[model samples]
Structures are given as C-alpha cells and as structure tokens.
Target: MLYRIFTDKEAFEEALYSYQTNLSIILAALLLMPFNYLMEVFKWQLSIKSLTYLPFKQATAGVLSGVSLGFVTPHAVGDYFAKIWSFSHEDRKKALGPILVARMSQMIPTLAFGAVAFIVFIQRKPVFDDYSSDYTSWLIPVAGLIAFLLLSFLFIKYGVKNKKWMYYFDLIRKLQLKSVAQLVALSSVRYFIFSVQFMLLLSIFSFPISFQQQFLGIAFMFLAKSVLPTFNFFNDLGIREFSAVLYFETFDISAAPVILASLLLWLINIALPALIGLFFVPQFKIDPS
Candidate 1:
C-alpha cells in the first residue's frame, strides 16, 4: 500500500513536507496509541472478570498477544484464541463468552455511530445525488434485514440445542447489566481515542476541510471500513484509504492528505501495537494434552 501511494511522487513529497513541519502533531498521535490499547486492556480485564480474575499485568500481556496474533488472521479470530489460551484448560471454554462480550462491546459503538454516519453521508447531495434513484440502495437494507432474521431463527432453533453452544448463552446470562454497560463505556473511550488520533493525523497533513466535515468524513470512513469484509493481509491496507478518498473527494479535498492520514493512523494504532506484541507472542504456548 505504501509503495502504491509513494508511486505518486507528488503525494509522497507533500506528506513528507507536512510531517517535517507538524512534528508535534505526529508525536501527539503516537502518544495516544498507548491510551488506545490501554482502554482495550481495561475492557479485556472487565470482560474476563466474569469468569476469572486476571491481574492487570497478565491482562495487558494477553491483550497485546491477541493484537499480535490478530494481525495475521482473518477478522482477528486469533484474538479469541489468544485470550482463551491465557487461562487453564479447564477455564478455556468459559473464556470464550467473555472474549466475545469484549469484542461485541467494542463493535457496538462502531455500528451505532457508523449507522448514523451512513445516514448523514447519504443525505449529502453532492455524493448521493445520483444514487438517490437507485433501487440497489434499497435492496441492501432489505437484504440485510432478511439475512439477520433468518440467522436469528436458525440460531434459536438449532444452535441452542448444541451442548457446546450453551456456554456462550450461559455466560451472557451470568453477566450483570452493570458489567455490560461498563464494557460499552470503556469501548466508547477506546473508539474516541482512535477517532481523535485520526483527526490529529489529518490536521498534521493539512486537510482543508472544516472540523464537522472532517469528523463526518472520518466517521463515515470508519463505518465503511468496519462493515466491509477483509482478509487479514488486506485488512488495514486499502479499504480505509479508499473510503476516505471516496468521502472527502466531494469536498474537493486532495486524496494525498486523506490517504496519508489513514495510513499513518493505521501505523500508530495497529502496526505499532502489533510490533510491541511480538515480545509477548513467544510466551503463548498451547498444550495438546
């Protein structure tokens, strides 16, 4: 992705010039990385508390390990195993429940905020004017609703009958309303941190949009990226750039800054943590016995 972007020599040069002058903004974005992941660690700590008491140090290590492994796997499925492996064999199955809860808590804000952003995005006549009459747009919502209902029916009728599946249902039942609310609150904080980091990176690149426009563009980009399917190899590479460019081009903003900001945000939030997590990766060992 970097190579592709750098191929456009003009964009590359502009980004470098921006970086040299806005060094402090770059530093600020980097500083937020710890707090972003720290929020995740706290979410992890709270999520697993229902099943086992994970100390702060161990939770931090486990969360980092999950990030490292998740970097290499589709949809970050490796994250679930990483957290589960942190427990004894006896507790591993139970751990799945909390791991899922932690994941869902994080996703709720993305979906909720993304839904609103999508609605607002479509209302922008400059972008959605042509698509206003398109039937395909209506098809997407109808299809989604049908699929959701079908899946819910199948899960209720068949999934609940499986003994192994009961673990997750039971775990959900065990969680109090307060704990669930706390998980959502912590996840919201993490989401806000990353969003601010993206905005900071944009400012560093001198994006010429108003604050509201920038926030809307960022929110829309995140929503599009989150809802789309991605293989692990391509997860952080192209989707974000495409989404940002697609949204901001309407405002006559240059693609260079938008693309660079998205890429830099990925580096600070995802790539950097994955590098730190490499240290803890070797410590995770699965027992076959």
Candidate 2:
C-alpha cells in the first residue's frame, strides 16, 4: 500500500534528478524566497492584528508554523489548528475569527486572478482553439460564477440577522469592506510575485513558449491547481506536473523538463517553508481548558 502510494512520487523524483538546470536560474529563483515569504508574513501579521496584536517577528513564526501545519494536513486546515494553539487558552477560542478571515482573504487573489486566467486560456490560447468554448459561450458560466460569489457574500452580509448561521460566520461580519479590499490588494501583490517566480523557473528550464502564451498557461495551471482540493501535499504533485505538461505542450515544451521544473517549485515554495515550520511547531501550545 505504501509503495503504491509513493509510485507517483518515485516518478517525479526520477525526472527531477535527471533534468539539467542552470545555476544562474536556480540562484535567481532562490532570491525570490525572502521577498515571497515576507509578503505572506506581512499579510498574516496584518490579518491577525485585527483580532489580537502580534509583533512582526512573532507573526512570522506563527505564519511559518501555520505553513508547516498546512503542509501536512489536507487544504492546510491544520493551519487554523496551529494558529489557535499558539494563543493562550482564552484567546485560543477567539482566534478562529482572524484565522478564518486571513484564509479567505488569501483566496481573494487566487479567485480574482484565476478567473481572468481561465478566460484568457479559454479564449486566446491555441490549445483551446478547438475547445468550442468561446467568449460568448463563456457568459452563462461566468454569470453563474458571479451569482454564486454574490450569494456567498450576501449570506455573509445578511446572516447576522439570523442567529442560526450568524455565529458561525460572525468573524466575517467584522470584516468590513475596506479591510477586505486591503486584503485583496495585499494578496494580489503576493500572487503576482509568485507567478513571476514560476515563469522565471520555467524559462530557466527552457520551456518552449512565448511570453504571452506562457502566461496563459501559467494562469490556467495555477487556477486549476487552486480550484481543486488536495488530500495532501503530494496529492497535488501529479496535478501540477500534468497541468504544466499539458499547457506547455501546446507550445512544444517537453514533459520531462516541465515536470522537473514543477518539482523544483514545489521544493522551493512548499517544502522549504514546511521544513522551517517544523522548528516553530514546538512552540505551539494548545489550551482547550
């Protein structure tokens, strides 16, 4: 069973090991790490500050710890668990508020960018040329998506009037429009940085793609990956490589190198932070009492 579970991983490692890489590209990619991480730390610090005050340094620790917890658990729900544990007993109970807002805020950029990316790929890309899905054909689904989002917002907006649903989403009630807007802006900056990093890495590996098409691929791949829920970090391993291979192949990029690039990205962005998070885990204290 364990061997079967790891079969996909074995394939990924084999490809990653066999691929040649540019040292300059690796160094350039590494340079984005601190800035990328700092953005997340900044966003988290600001979000949590709305509920409980935390200095930047401590917030960094919490964010990393959350990263680790998120890494091991599906959808990183453990992120919330680790966060609340970091607080005192009394605060632990209330900590869910900020954590919930922080998480949803993080998704704002993904949703916004993902929506655009989906449209771009569906319309402009050659692969989608025969897809039979055109911009006008896009209206119904887009309208449905918009309606869904609006309904979710309306629930959050007016749920306060009804006690049954209000308490559960109470934190959302405190999330004023201005604050949500700020979170979206902050998240957008982070999303742009991460997208650039992915492109840099792809170029480093010599992905055969034009700049415009490359972004179209990136948008769809990132959007698709985020749209699905992963059972574990490794669960998305196949998804990332497959998505990259599919999109890049439209431009004649080979699969092996693309898979390797995706692996390196996972190592850089997810695995490294998760390893760092392990150190902060010891500091987590849960006080259910």
**What TM-score would every model get versus the actual structure?**
0.83, 0.80
Candidate 2: the clashing residue pairs are: none
Candidate 2 colliding pairs, count:
0
Residues 8-33 of candidate 2: C-alpha lDDT, one tens digit per residue: 67555645654444667767876887
Which candidate wins on lDDT? 1
| Candidate 2 Cα outliers beyond 4 Å, as residue runs | 1-21, 119-151, 161-165
RMSD in Å for candidate 2, one decimal? Answer: 4.7
Per-residue C-alpha lDDT of model 1 across residues 99-152, encoded as one tens digit per residue:
766776676667665654565567653323456555455446545643553454
Query: Which of the numbered candidates is closest to the native, going by highest TM-score?
Result: 1
